[model samples]
Target: MDLLPLAVSSVIFLLVSVFLYSWKLNSSGTKLPPGPRGLPILGYLPFLDRNLHLQFTILARKYGPIYRLWLGSKLCIVVSSPSLIKQVVRDQDTVFANRDPTIAALLGTGGVDIITSPYGPYWSNLRKLFASEMLSHANLDASYVLRRNEVRRAIRNVQEKIGTGVDIGELIFVTELNVVMSLLWGGTFEGEKRDRIGAEFREKVSKFIELLEKPNLSDFFPVLARFDFQGIAKEMKDLLPSFDEILDYVINDRLKIMDSEQVEGELPSAKRGKDFVQILLDLKEQNVAEESMTLTQIKVLLVYSTTIT
Candidate 1:
């Protein structure tokens, strides 16, 4: 019995050792695209600049249209040539279309929103909802008045600040926010509350964008993700709750309206007008697309439809 046990242990140890050795050999033999070398372990991470696009352009000129760099342990392939871009984005669209959602995006969206959701059945449904339901000519026509009013408000806002060198980007962002929110829910933010909320939203969104672009060690080194040394993931998770709370309020408020309208025996089409929330809610009630539509999915759609615009 002792000999049998010893022999079994020895065989297991030998198999484990052989597997590790083979894995090391395979990893060493794997080919990757060529680019500048960097320090051990850290890779080219320490030398990256804030203006990464400019650096990428210079590197592309030196390293050719396509090159790879190791950002920590993550291998990033950069394609600069128009032909290569077209190949990736067009010809092999499906093959290369899926995005690698960053830690921040995963937290912010709960890994469900259409933009960052992995390509699959759920993503397909979201796309169909956008193309078939939301972007229909009828819906666009219904939303025209809201867009026109918001555009007019933007014009007035700009006019009031005409002599003060108003920031054009800020003006456009506010205008888009107003238009998108109005179309999504058929409501407008106005007066002091609007100003306060708009400022807060812009600040939070700006910070979110910065964090999204900032390289997180967790991204390059999966082993370090749990530690979140940069706090990028935590910050994004915190910011998301505020936005979610706002979206929740809007969603619940719409639900209340839907309940009241149902009790009053008002047809949904008549009671809710042509806003996006109403349309989605109506679809929910029909129970026809149950697999494709869920309450969580609807909420995710509403959040992104307003903000992403």
Candidate 2:
């Protein structure tokens, strides 16, 4: 009588059978760490709390430091506790040291930023170039003047709001954000623009963090990983353009400086502070001479550098 439900059940049974067959074929005899029991289709997803960290921590306590949890069809290995963390981070560092795939990183970064990028020859080279060029001690020292000025401005803003019963959380976020923005973009926002950019960046960063920390069913269940049940892919597509616009502004401003025949030391007293952008541009030139760096690679490096710091 209920042929629709029967049909749906048949399809689900077929999928599960296929998945089990594949698992049996490829899975090694090596045993995974203990974990909570998972149900069909949903796995352990229904058991998980909305706050992933707390949920995992509870499981870690019960199941030991290393335990697996299923989010939908995917099985995720959660590593917790200080001792296990140290063992992975220090002892077996290399074996555990690999970046997640591009799609996974993109879900968290809104683009291919450096921090979430997988460990590879290209990533290694780009990281080294950034370290030696942009984040070097001399470069950081050069940018100190920018930091000082921005800090002073932040203090002044706080002073003005001393008795206005301002939101401490908002104030602190804006102050820290301005310091970072000045280091990266060479100026702080003011008036309405300040509030807007600060709010926008905060929201974007929060979303990115949320996406990264949450367990995706697709990430664990290779068979169903293609289906983005959480709408993570849609969110990434929407967020990337705004991120690109910010990056474009940084890159274009640096290029304008390079096009001007002005030497760094000869910069006016007011514009003397050299920021990360200048350092990255110089690295880009070096990369061109040593290896044929493409435009996309250069842009990727810049995007990565900005995201990390």
Top lDDT prediction, candidate number: 1
User: Measured by C-alpha RMSD in angstroms, how accurate is candidate 1?
Assistant: 7.6
Cα lDDT tens digits, model 2, 39-68, are 655667777777879888788789998987
TM-score of each: 0.77, 0.76
Model 1 ranges with Cα > 4 A deviation: 1-30, 158-170, 188-207, 262-273, 287-292
Candidate 2 Cα outliers beyond 4 Å, as residue runs: 1-30, 102-104, 107-112, 130-132, 187-230, 263-270, 288-308
Q: Mind giving the per-residue lDDT tens digits that candidate 1 earns over 48-86?
A: 988889999999999999987767766689999999999
How far residue 181's Cα lies from its native spot in candidate 2, in Å, is: 0.9
Give model 2's clash tally: 3
Tell me the number of clashing residue pairs for each predicted model.
Answer: 0, 3
Lowest lDDT sum, 10 consecutive residues, model 2, at 261-270
